[model samples]
Target: MRQTRRAIALFLLVCSILVPLPVGARQAAANPFAELGLPELAVTITDTAIEGAPAERTAGRYVLAVTNDSTAGAPPVVSAGVGFLQPPEGMTAADLIAFFATMATGPDGGASPVASPGAAAEMEGPPPWYYEVPLAGGIYALPGETAYTVLDLAAGEWVLWAEDPTAPRPPVAITVTGEAPANQPVPEADVTITMTEMAFALDQPLAAGPQIIALTNEGQQPHFLVLATVPDGTTVDDVLQLSMTFMDPSATPPPNLSFEQMQDIANTADLSAGITNWFSVDLESGSYLLVCFVPDQETGIPHAMLGMIDVVTVP
Candidate 1:
């Protein structure tokens, strides 16, 4: 039968490209952890993959295989935190809990190996908002394993609530609508962007799809917000000399990462005093900048040359 109808249409196009996303089809964004690519505290889990639905905001290393079952085997207490982010029909829930206070967090379950600099929940509470780059080992988990360690976010509309905090009624929130570019965060006209001190004020424009760059570190120190994109115009001193040029495997550009390139990407994160960070991308406009560098050794200056830099547009 024509090779069984071309092998049943290539097995339904490889099950529609591997599949993974059913829990309501996912798309209620504004900061659903940048569609789940992560940022806004943390929530990574991997083991093989088979829990069920919910996970589509780009699905990067945001890991979440989680399938312990745990009913008679008992362990059903897998909670995660950070709130707000599920509004848009008219908006207003305190502006989506002030965009989930930049990544609030509560359970923390794991990952807290030392480095609690001062604790307000460890260096500037990501819970009522506050940060200057302090989310290193953000509430890790690993026991039977299902990973994700560091997180960085500040976009907006946030929400990363996984429950079992003794579970009774509500918990599995997960409303991280971040990443803007395609249609550019369609907030109608109220599109805002402000990061403070370290930088970012960029008035408006950005709604093509996936751009979510929202930071909020009230300032005091420790900050981070990387984000990358080159080619068009490319200047800001060549984007700070390509963000300190890193890629020298014994020179002569032996492996690849050199043309003086830099792209680890961090659109928003590493906050401290007042905490908040978020970085998303889906851009195509051109000449963008949001730098930081984080230096401060008493005053070595590096908050992107003390300005933090900002010149976004994204159409």
Candidate 2:
């Protein structure tokens, strides 16, 4: 009898080990894109140059994996914002570099006209060539960390560059050919943030945890989202007031809020009208302010000043 009981107990233990996990547990561990089989492009940014992008790709949705590896200076690049631009016909990468240089310093090497808020509005809009180009959204990543963003690209020649004007790196060019694959898998998003003219509309309230966000630009002009955590008792109006001082060198700082109190959580590159992108962010329970600082097409004033700021609670 003892021998028979031992044999039955061993069989039960083996059966327990062979049984599969529940469906929900398996789904959570699976890769989100495993079924779609999307091609991934790895982009690396260093202090001197950008690398690892292929010269050609099929025009379609792509997962851009960006990594920043700069360690050269005090306060090294914590986060690098990469931007994609489709230059107008007859323009070369060199011309785009020259334009960025002129925008940083004046044509005569004097202070940039954009440095003064009053002059920025007074001056005529960007050169005519600027209007012809299209702005595609890109991703941001911290130093030594990898971040991902899904970009649906059309057939064209695209230019990739560092979005920061103060640290302009040589831009790289890539030619996209063919149409995007049909029936692409749309990411399952926990929240959707829609960008309209000078405002942001959220589909649902946010919860504190990892979230996949779908960002869509339905507005007439280009826009981007920047989510930052502010100190307790800070309001959207206070953030707007502080932002104005950053834009205008002559404007006075707000008495209540200082720059040190705010911490940037997530940011996206400029996305033109009709562009949609998906990114992932993890937030702790707190108050976050979402603001867009992209300048208006006609007036140079940032959208945040025109009431494009909102405060949300993650509880």
Candidate 3:
């Protein structure tokens, strides 16, 4: 099981570099929220640091544009997002950093355990502090790609980071004050995908080519979207069987189908409940497997195994 988990992680890391941007260009022509006149936060991730976060801003909706400027040799994948937390009065950013360090080490003063389908069920629950910090959804983009997401910031202290622990960069702290902007219009979406308990609901058929996708987490727990292209004649049952082999430690993985056989086209960071975000993607005409690997809060099983897996045809 440990080997299988490691193989999957390595596969994701490799896919981050090999996956082609669905959109042909590296940058988008305009901000999706440009018409709303919202503040635009330009976040650039390079080899050295994460740049463009302001020290303070008025509480309101803003467009977060994340650009990956890292070299091919640098970390090819970046998960940049905003995390909101309201610590007790008088708490400082340094205090929060210390808290994060403790969380990373777990209660045993050792490294935290990797989350897996088998191990998740054995856990009691996340630490109490986990609920205190809410992650605002962000982009999961590769080098040279720029992705956008809408952030509705409230008056509070928010931290922006790469969300990768091995990167060794400090989180950027922002103080949001004043009233939030009112009556902001939601950006138009080409297709809307709603996440519910152990299922995904699509408002319309997903067409081929570049289009804005709106993702809403209506489920009680957090969820994410991952779309990968599969060969012709592939079915949802085939995906389920492959995933089951990967999740089970005792089962031997099938030789015919492996993670390397699929091409991952889209991956989004986890979004908390009631949070809606948009991303743009373009896919070739083919069948793609949509699955969410988020573990269930109660059973620790991945949502994909519980009927969240589906094959959508892009025509």
Candidate 4:
């Protein structure tokens, strides 16, 4: 009887080890693209240059895996531009380099890329546009914070470059050679954030976890989502006060938490007016903020100041 009992116990233990885990008990998968059922274009970004970018790809729904491989320096940020760079008549290499440098400085205190000299006219407009994705190594450098942007690209020659002027790598040239891939099923969004001319509208707060957030642009201009975590006790007023100094340099900035204290998680690249796009993000539980920093073409004022800023809670 004792021997039969031992054998039965051992068999049960083995069966338990071999059996599959219950769906609810299994850990959630982390691949953002896989979870969303979208094709992925893995792109590695470093302080010097981008690597593993395909020279040619089929135009279609693609999730850009923009990984910030820079383990040092300021946190890295990247953006993609699709267009030909045609320097104006008789523009020198030195001039071209200077033009790129100026463009990299961003709009705040830098000269507009639209009006720069030399190759300032390099990028032809209308078809030319840029998109940005926020990467990890932020305030806390939280793991698995890789940024993603879904792009429905058309067949054409495209250019991808880092928005950070300091990155040493040259621009990458990509050719969209084939037809776009088939559309994938859109994942259900746990939280949907609607964006207007200069404001953000969300139905309610978000529960922390791997989540799909849908961004709908209902305004007349393009906008993007930057997910950031503010320090505990930080309020909307504190953010606004700091903004005053940013908008008007002469104004005494609030002594509240500056940019250094905030941790950026991810960003949804530019969503054109009337266009909607969704991306997957690992939402950690914390106090967060959503803002669109894109400046208005007419006023040159950041959309965040136009009431695009909002405090978000991820519990």
Q: Give per-residue CA lDDT, model 1, range 1-315, as digits (tens).
A: 222222222322211111111121112113434334432333333332222334334312232222222222122222122222233444443554333332232236432122211211112212222222223112212123222222333343333322111121122323334553342221122233555665666456655565454455556765544444444555566544433332112223223222323322223324455544333445565544556654443544456656776545455
TM-score of 2: 0.79
Q: What's the best-to-worst order under lDDT?
A: 2, 3, 4, 1
Scored by lDDT, model 4 comes in at: 0.52
Clashes per model (N, Cα, C within 3 A) = 55, 0, 0, 2
**For residues 9-120, what per-residue lDDT tens digits would candidate 3 score against the true structure?**
3323322422233322354345656776767888877776777889998887778887777664433233333333444345665676565555445457666454444542
Question: Which model is ahead, 2 or 3, in terms of TM-score?
Answer: 2
Q: What do the candidate models score in CA lDDT, each in turn?
A: 0.35, 0.66, 0.63, 0.52
lDDT of 4 by residue, 54-85 (tens): 87777666666565454332232222222122
| Model 1 residue 99 CA deviation in Å | 24
Stretches > 4 Å off in candidate 2: 1-36, 72-78, 92-125, 128-132, 248-252
RMSD of 4: 18.4
Model 4, C-alpha of 269: deviation from truth (Å): 2.9
Q: In model 4, what is the error at residue 276, expressed in angstroms?
A: 3.6
Candidate 3 error regions (>4 Å): 1-33, 71-93, 102-133, 164-167, 240-251, 254-256
| lDDT of each residue in 1-315, candidate 2, tens digit only | 222222222222211111111111111112234455678887888886778978898888887777766542332123565778887678775566665555545447764322223333333333444434677788766555667777787898888877643343567788889998889878888999999998999999878888888999999887888777766677887776665553455877678776656655667777888888888887898888888765566765567778788888887
Worst 10 residues of 1 by lDDT: 14-23
Clash-forming residue pairs, model 2:
none
Best candidate per lDDT, number? 2
Model 2 residue 9 lDDT?
Answer: 24
User: Candidate 3 at 69: error in angstroms?
Assistant: 2.4
Checking candidate 3 for backbone clashes, the offending pairs are none
